[model samples]
Target: MPEAKREAWITGVGIVSTLGEGADAHWQKLSAAQPGADTTTFAPFVVHPLAPLNFDAQIPKKGDQRQMENWQRIGTYAAGLALDSAGVKGKPELLSQMDMIVAAGGGERDLNVDATILNGYTQAANPAAFLNERLMGDLRPTLFLAQLSNLLAGNISIVHGVTGSSRTFMGEEAAGVDAVRIALSRITAGQSDIALVGGAHNGERPEMLMLYEFAGQCLKDKFAPIWERGDKGGFALGSLGAFLVIEARDHAEKRGAKPLARLSAVVADRASRKPGTITETLGKLWDKIKDKVKGGQTAILSGATGSTQATAEERAFLEQHGELAVRATATYLGHGMEPQFAMNVALATVALAHGSLYPPSDQTGLEKPMSGSLDQVVVTGVGHWRGEGMALVERVG
Candidate 1:
């Protein structure tokens, strides 16, 4: 006989966004349809800047906070919040056994060093030699050490004391998809009893905006909701941190941990993104758990990054399921790349716990009033470039 699958439950969620910190703060703001973005700060490019946060509350060590970049500090702080939410913070016994999965992107670059090299190359007697000399001597060794993607996991381990098996995945939005997918899968397969999963993005950086702008994916000259961005839709990058604590249901019960919600299943795929590929892949992903999605109680919490092809293709897929109420969270949180999917899943859990979806904040016909009790949530993730994924989160009680 085959072994039955163990249930996965979301015991805790920690997210810090432009709206604020924790689930309660976000609920209060989003519930009132007050989603704000800073258009003037980044100017031509819109961004949802992170709210004020005290690193001391989480990292506690000045040396630890000083060595890390803003993005890492954001992630480490969020991880501490998740540990606290799970009732495991400072408990070495529970933390020592907890696993961790982080979705990460490359660390920030040294723009000052880059600028010096760029200016010197034009005026140097030997441009090539000047470039090599500056590259070797100008950039600090510690800067490169801070750039590795796995350091987020390392810092989380050091700060929060989650010392069990650790893994970090990269590849933008797809990383977020697989991070949660694998965490839920492991819990369900009885391989891991508890795991921390999520990522962070620092969208306030000039280089990021420049990079996305080059790809023609940055929203410019005015901010609009994701759905209403029209023909040339683009994503407004968001500066935020998101993390979740997922564990086996039986294990949570044994530890006297209350499950905020059940992670029923997670499915992911890399869509070729040509023509109708995103729509087709999303359809297939939805099939993996469509049976568990209850009609009136279910709604879609979309991580639609508002990039042209991706947003349009995801919309095409959503049109097929027009009956399902959909809220593209990028309309509010903006798009935080590797962490967007996890953030939406966290939002879904918060909404489910509240028994109602937050009020609509956009003029787009796509986002409508829920008009029903909430229980099941279908969180959709469509990477700006390649991935397509869906996860089903259901209310525990």
Candidate 2:
């Protein structure tokens, strides 16, 4: 089959994040500015652009950290919601024929099995060393099991009776999109009629925070020290799990499914990880999308993480498209890491399906345009000019 001939439509979705679990809560949190992202925290002296963390937006009680690793909690919760959205919940027979693809990075760093093993070895060698190694401590084997990314697929498969092929990928921020490409390719090749595609990452870890800080990528605020030092649009740290059910359009319709939007096209490329080529890569994506998007799309759900380089390039792309409106959901979803783009794709599906824009996080007095606006960084719920609300924009390769 040809690339253009391959078609996929989203029939369902699920999300699990600091905004709380379930699709309804996810929609509510993103559709409006929730009062949680701004809470203050005194845990560590990390330089946050919106630091002094005023909102108490940590994981909710239902998350049950004692039973699952952060990644597993996010992955499973999101997957369940996606299956529910597709109306395939609790039906193992329907999912048994589908393929599964899960994405994530820094998988289970906090659940360090290496340290545990080292302690175990020392304890076996010397009984007294057990005390020093804390080998007798209550070690939760379940914690280690929860750390594997595949367990995410396993949980969903067991619930849905998905006995077909399964796969997982890792590459930090790029894993989410890669998972989509893989799933789409498999369907195009007739490997399966449906797929559960998504990416998962945890922000509650010190590594994600450390990496963000080292990169100097916090969202800018009036009080952030990084802002005073000339850093702008500082990024926020938050967790996200986003998944979509991708199936052929005809198949979806035959099953009485309402598609959010047609997966008309998806393309990605990589250059050296530097500031200069990010725009070029996105431009390449635009090129591939130009013909498909030109007359059909009125809104662009950007993966802009509010970092200096990404935001600048995205702004440049919008600037060239004079009159094409843009809507960035990350402003509301918090700083998305791996599978971040998947979350944005989900938000786009929501807008395309419902014709409603999810509002952006208010950055004090900053009056930005909803990325939906032509050549501007427009925020959502401002003066959004709702167009046809279809994903018709084509890539101009």
Candidate 3:
């Protein structure tokens, strides 16, 4: 006889975003319908800056905090929060064995170095040599190493002692979806007993804004609810850190850890995004998990970055399943790139644990108020440009 598959539970969640830190703070902010966006900081371009965090609380070592860039510090801090939430913070045994998966983008660029290179290269007689010289001299030796996406996982291991197997995924929104999917898959298959998974993004950089602006994807000037962006759609880059501690049901039970919610299913897909492709891909993903949803007790936490075409397509997909109460988190939290999906999943776990969904922020009437007991949440991630994914998070009895 074949051995039965194990179940995966969301045992811990650590989130820090524009709204605030931890599950309680976020829940309170959402419940009150207050957005934490900053339209003036990076003006003409709107951004949701991270709430002020005292890094010493989680990182402890000032040296560790100093060496890491802002994004690394955010991710490591969030990972520590997850460990604390899971009751494994100082447990050497658990820390030694807890596997880790992170979704990350390339590290922040040095604006000064970039500006110098651009300004000098255009004026220098030997532009090629000037560029090469600047590349060799102007860039810090450690900048190259710091830019590696896996460094976030490495920093978590160093600071939090989560030294188990580590894997890093690097494709923006899809990376966040895959990180959770793989972590849950490993636990459910009994290959792993516990894992820490999530990602972080610092979207307040000039270079990052410019990079996205090149593609015409940055939300500018006025900040509007994601659904209201309509034809003038773009994403307000957000700075956030999100991490979750997921464990096998038996493992959590053995450790006396209570689950916030059960991760029942996660499905990810990529469509060409040619007109109706996203809607079609989302339809297929929905079909796989739709049966797991119970009407009246279910809601959706949508990871819809206000990027033009993708947001519209996601809205269309949500319209197809109008019965489910929907909330586009990007409207409040802003878009945190690689961490968007994980952040939304964490929010879903929060909602299921609380047994209620937050009131809608949309004035367009697309998002309606949900009442009564909330037992399940279908977290949707329609990537700004590429991937589409969904997860079913259910209340644990």
Arranged by lDDT with the best first, the candidates are 3, 1, 2
lDDT, candidate 3, 1-397, per-residue tens: 1232888899999999988899999999999986657889788899999999999999999989877989999999898888898999989899898999999998988888888899999999999999999899877777778899999999999988898999999999999999999998888888899999999999889889988999999998898999999898799999999999999999999989999899999999999999989988999998888777888899989999998999888889999989989999998889998989889999999998899999999889899999799999999998888899999999999
Candidate 2 residues 172-261, lDDT tens each?
556666777667767666666888888666666666665566767654333231112223555565677888888876677778887766
What is the alpha-carbon lDDT of model 2 when measured against the actual structure? 0.57
| C-alpha RMSD for every candidate | 1.6, 7.8, 1.8
TM-score of 3: 0.97
Error of 2 at 375 (Å): 19
Give the clashing residue pairs of candidate 3, or none: none
Candidate 2 vs 3: which has more lDDT? 3
Error of 1 at 374 (Å): 0.4
Candidate 2: misplaced stretches above 4 Å?
A: 20-24, 33-36, 42-67, 109-142, 218-233, 295-297, 359-397
